[model samples]
Target: MAHVTFKENRITLIGNEVKTGNKAPDFTLLANDLSEVTLADTTGKVRIISVVPSIDTGVCDAQTRRFNEEAAKLENVDVLTVSADLPFAQSRWCAAAGLENIKTLSDHRDFSFAQNYGVGIEELRLLARSVFVLDSKDNVTYVEYVSEATNHPNYDAAIEAAKAAN
Candidate 1:
């Protein structure tokens, strides 16, 4: 397992750490409308799964917005931002941020997405900052488990991986 920290304090992560060659794990998450969304629903498109501790936080917001900007240029790619924030809050944040290119998903229901993706922080019940890029065939082509919860991810590398997956 990879070592993760929040505010420089170590935290234990649940589940197996995902790797680049592993098949993407399927999990259920809530859409902004409280509808159930599963990985299979987006089977045919390359996907960038942005895992954040909270959408309202500074690093999380910037991360999502960065992906939102890139989503426009990446054809057939779905940029999904997953967080444990409530669906209502996620919806409001999306509206306030004018984010339309990316989908904001809530994992508050069971934290299943966090656990399945190995980004779950046991101490805070939040996901660690990370990014995963999946090919159209559902293979994980790139994954970055950010060592610190409050930091940013490698946006350039993630974008390059998404483009290469195409």
Candidate 2:
């Protein structure tokens, strides 16, 4: 498990941490439209899964927006922001922020994505900050479990990994 801290205090992450070269775990999350979205649905494209506690927060907002912009330029890459926020809230935030390139998915219903990816923060019922890149064949090409929950991740490294996978 990844040792995680939120606001400087330690928190327990629910699942085993995934690493590069591992088979990416499959999960069912809710899309903005409330439809079930599975990893299998994204089979043929390189995926960048951005995990955050909540989309309404400063760091999460900025992170999603940054990926949205990057997604516009990455060929054959799908950037998906996963959070514990409700699907309605996720949709609202994306609309208000004018973010279209990156698809925001909600793990609020079952915490499946959070638990499977080992990013769920048990103390807060939110996801720990992390980033994952998966190639077309669903192998994890890169993984970043950000040490601090409130801090930003290594955006450049994640992007580079996605580009390489694509």
Judge candidate 2 against the unseen true structure and give its global Cα lDDT, from 0 to 1.
Answer: 0.93
Off by over 4 Å in 2: none
Which window of 10 residues has the lowest lDDT sum in candidate 2? 114-123
TM-score of 2: 0.98
Residue 111 C-alpha lDDT in model 2? 91
Name the weakest run of 10 consecutive residues (lDDT summed) in model 1: 110-119
Segments in model 1 whose C-alpha atoms lie over 4 Å from true places: none
Question: What lDDT score goes with residue 84 in model 1?
Answer: 90
Taken over the whole model, the C-alpha lDDT of each candidate is 0.93, 0.93
> What would you estimate as the lDDT of candidate 1?
0.93
lDDT of 2 by residue, 67-109 (tens): 9999999999999999999999999998899988988899999
TM agreement with the true structure for every prediction: 0.98, 0.98
